[model samples]
Target: MKILNPFRLGLLGGLGVLVAVGIGQTVISLATILTYVGAALFLALGLDPVVTWLETKKFPRWTAILTVLAGVLGVFTGLIFAIVPVIAEQVRNAVQATPRLVTAFFDGTVRENVETALPWLGVQDLLDGFNEWAADLDVTTIGGGVFAVGIGIATGITGAIIVLILTIYFVSSLNGIKSGIYQLVPATKRAKFIDLAEQVSAAVGRYVIGQGSLALVNGVLSFIVLTLIFPAFGLPVKYSALLAFIAFMGSLIPLVGTLSGSIVITLLVLLFNGSPSVIAVGIYYLVYMQLEAYVLNPRIMNKAVKIPGALVVIAALAGGTLLGILGALIAIPVAAAILIVVQQVIIPRQADL
Candidate 1:
């Protein structure tokens, strides 16, 4: 018998492992694609009530779909028209006055605080270094960077449009797609899986509708408050409504949503009227957050997502860590699915035993 070479055997084993890993990665990518498809289908299901109502009045399916799409597009276009100009004007003003704001702030407040807090600290030297650094900073260079970012955002928007188109296509044929999937499962498991899928779809649909309603309410309230308060401070009132609307949309996400909204609003405030406006914005956000938590959230989200607060936080953190923003967005639905499986399948099975 010829002796096998150990080195050759070892190399072959490593190659096999690499091939397995590649295959596993490919499967994961495919699964992720399927998940996205399923999510789109669920969104369509959520919209089905509207579609059905239209059909009852003798509207064709295609016409109803077109109507829905048109409505969505109109809303988005109106939002852009309302918001972009205000933000642009505020940003321009902020950039022009940054140096003066920094000089006044350092000279009047920061220097005094630093000296009082730390007698041994070289407050004047630190201020000099900060001023030197600020002087060296080129606003033109920053503008160039912002322009590059705008280009990137344009590209991303194009990609998003493509994905939305695909999602619409998939959602339109959700029933057919689901039937095809059902046929693939073993006869014994098909019914169970179908039931599970329905539960998950319903849960996701409820969550989306509930959240959308909450966001709309929050946005309208913020806009009213900002419009009332901004004029008193000599800030542009027209833009405050736009800023508030943006903040409301941002507040749709779980833990980070309100914070992200606050950051955007704070920046806009600071841009328009410096540090004092920023401070006022902060107070507004704090009050809004408290009201939202105690009143708005409980009333809106209670029935939609029954998961505990701690679980929501954990799921959001884990999803954000594993898959970034998309993960965080889908985390609650995924958790709800798991909860359904536990309550419907595993627990019942155990009880039977």
Candidate 2:
């Protein structure tokens, strides 16, 4: 301070700038890192049972890790190959038929129904505004937008792949990692922290496995129902599976996701066949939701994640509001993790004190 060292001043200034930049960039990087870490942790937790079994059987940790990674890769590849083409075809057909669907719906009996029901609602005015908006949306603009979205999806997929690789590595070394982390804690606190971590890991793992099973059941049930109903309505049969899959994915989003999916599917049905089909599809979804809420959810999810219905809805809404689809997908698991921490650590610690 007496000499006012220029070198020290420069170093301090550089450090300040770096800290500013980190703070500025944190919002962008925070979500990405959280997502990757959450995914990896969940994956490791899910495979913990298998790892334990392997250890019991005297399998080397590296070998068990390789086996788990291979299984995961195989499942992912199979799903991609089996599902992507069907979805791609449905998307292509849906795009091609959009104008026809719009024309038919507006020109046909549906228009009369809308006119009658929504006379005061200015339904036609809304359509007119939509048309105006569509007119302003040129092909080049739409195409450019689609291209940009495609690039973003590709980048996301690449990031997911990297995360998956990291997950495998982390899972393989989970024991070592846990030991190292515990060592950093005071000896008195280490055991409690380790126990809390295990509880959290178990909660998240069970939730993931349960959700996957539920999604599969939903998908299968939807496909069966759509396949049966589409033919009676005289819509394109080829798109049924694709539509069902979309609905299945959407159902994973908790509250609003199913509703959004139902709307999209109903529109597709209306586009191809008519309003009667749309009404039928709506009825089907309503019934499906009832069954899922009452039967499937309780039977399947109860064992894995015992979240309250109100909490699930609240978490889903908050997550969707904050981060869109990805947020919604992860909201339940995050809530489960928090619940475990509260039940196993915080509450007990408070009680002890």
Candidate 3:
């Protein structure tokens, strides 16, 4: 065999490494944009089933898209209106309650109770230290913190708007996007690729729909129990809407979400509403979890890809480690897509070999 030229090999290897580094840097710089695009695409896929269903019912494609978007916007707007005033009122109440709480800690029955419960601990000294720390907080530091919070809020709002616009565009043109992507494959493999792609898409869409239904059921039931039933039974549940919102969001995640939300809500009830309310909430959630696992999940997710439980856990953990909540949310579907490819493409080819 002819000897390779060491210098030429080294030069080529170095160039390849440099090119990879450049691409990596570019990706890092564009991470936020990429995240927004990915989120929009995910949301679009989730909404696709509804649009298609509407189309099948004789709705014009554009009209169906518009209707879906309108409904989503309406729901979002209604939530904002419902939530904001409550949040603002809570903030105002908190600010007004702070001085009273401080007074109670130092001079009221709260101090006595704490002293009685923890005779060994220096509650006064602890309070003094906390006060000293608070006193040491400078105006500039507080202002900076406030400014940072404002900046974060603004950035979040901007990102939401960008994602919404991108989602609308993606939803409107998803079919075209799929057709364009199919063209990139070799003609010989294009049909198979399209078939696999459609299956993957359908799996993702069904998963989204199933998960959303579960979340919605959790949210609605939570709201009814907290906002209506509890009060009727003389158990006051403060921030019912907010608590329900938390339940809704948590249930959107796969395996662990509902349990996590229930635990959080139970803890909150225990802290704020005492033993009786906590007991009620805890019992309700425990029963709900059983129903969900036995009845809701199996029925709702029947049409979606049936990922192994262990695989789902592993996939969720890996995805969450890589990309946080969004990663966790999409991980199962991604795993399913890979499973499909292996089953349909790889195994058969391997068998032939």
Candidate 4:
């Protein structure tokens, strides 16, 4: 036994290392799966309000769930069918136009306009450096980037399908899932947990609905402005649809989404149209951003979840810093949920004790 003890210990140590390596590999493999599941869970929470509304109307739970699921799937399927081809065509147009756009950007007309618009800001030197750098490169250099973009598109489509399926399953079983989770808590705490959970789910669902509505409005407004200006800019109106879609998708991300989307769309316009078009875009978004903040957001999001202005900014910054875009997207709702729990559950419990 004494002689065998060291050998046994070494064997166990080797086995422990193998187990650790296996666990790491398994986690890496499941990273994508976890991401899909998390996204699906968020969607399910967001859809809970629709199901609850249907239930209030005397519809059975399964009936409500199925109806909402079908409607969502139909809308998404229709959009995918309608947009995929158009986006592919736009990508081709963008690729063909890049070199030309770069050439246009360094022209005298654009330089004069930029200098005139911002008298203190010298733009010619910047343009000259960019032109020099660009002249040393060619369109073929973008091939690898385009190929990566293609791969991203393919992966995104697959991920969307998986998330959709997972979302349906999660929503259908939401009550069961909640009940199962509640069972893990002590009986005394179960009621409070259930109430808090319901509030969180409903808030999240309303936030989703409100955000979607805001995105639609933003997209429509962007499309109208871009289209009206396109004629004067000597560009076709057809490209407006692509730009609108980009705005719509981008605006789904919270806080900074509008700015990011606007910047992107504006740059593309500048590339195709000119400095004048970029100025128009800048002016439109400036006024529109004010309108969105003071008018649209207050009316729409007021009913959804009301976190203080300061908290919203802090949460968004922290989320963005920690987890990039997804974190930012969910931060406001999460903050509201936490606030609700603190006010309703935590405070009351503390007071009672």
Highest-scoring model, lDDT: 3
- Runs of candidate 2 exceeding 4 Å displacement: 1-34, 50-67, 99-123, 135-144, 228-238
Q: In candidate 1, list every pair of residues with a backbone clash.
A: none
User: C-alpha displacement of 192 in model 1, angstroms?
Assistant: 2.4
Ranking by TM-score: 3, 4, 2, 1
Instruction: Report lDDT (CA) for all predictions.
Output: 0.73, 0.76, 0.86, 0.83
In candidate 2, clashing pairs total 0
Stretches of candidate 4 off by over 4 Å are 1-29, 105-121, 131-146, 228-238
- Give the per-residue lDDT of model 4 (tens digit) for 1-353: 46668888999999999999999999889988987887788888989889989999999988999999999988888787887677778778887877865565655655665665556776867877876887798677778888999899899989989999999999999989998999999999888788888889899889989998999999888877777765666644446778889999988988889888988887676556555566777788888888998999999989998889899899989888866776787888899999998999789989999
Per-residue lDDT of 184-279 in model 3, one digit per residue for the tens?
999999999999998898889888889899999999999999999988999887667768878998999888899999999886665445556767
lDDT of 1 by residue, 79-124 (tens): 5786766767756765676686667565665455344444687867
Which structure among the candidates has the greatest TM-score? 3
- Residue 241 of model 1: what lDDT? 59
Q: Candidates 1 and 2: which is better by lDDT?
A: 2
Candidate 1, residue 10: Cα displacement in angstroms equals 7.4
How many clashes in candidate 4?
Answer: 0
- What residue pairs are clashing in model 3? none
lDDT: which is higher, 1 or 3? 3
- Residue-by-residue lDDT tens digits, candidate 2, 162-223: 78887887788888887888899998888888887777767667776777776777778778
Model 4 residue 165 CA deviation in Å: 1.7
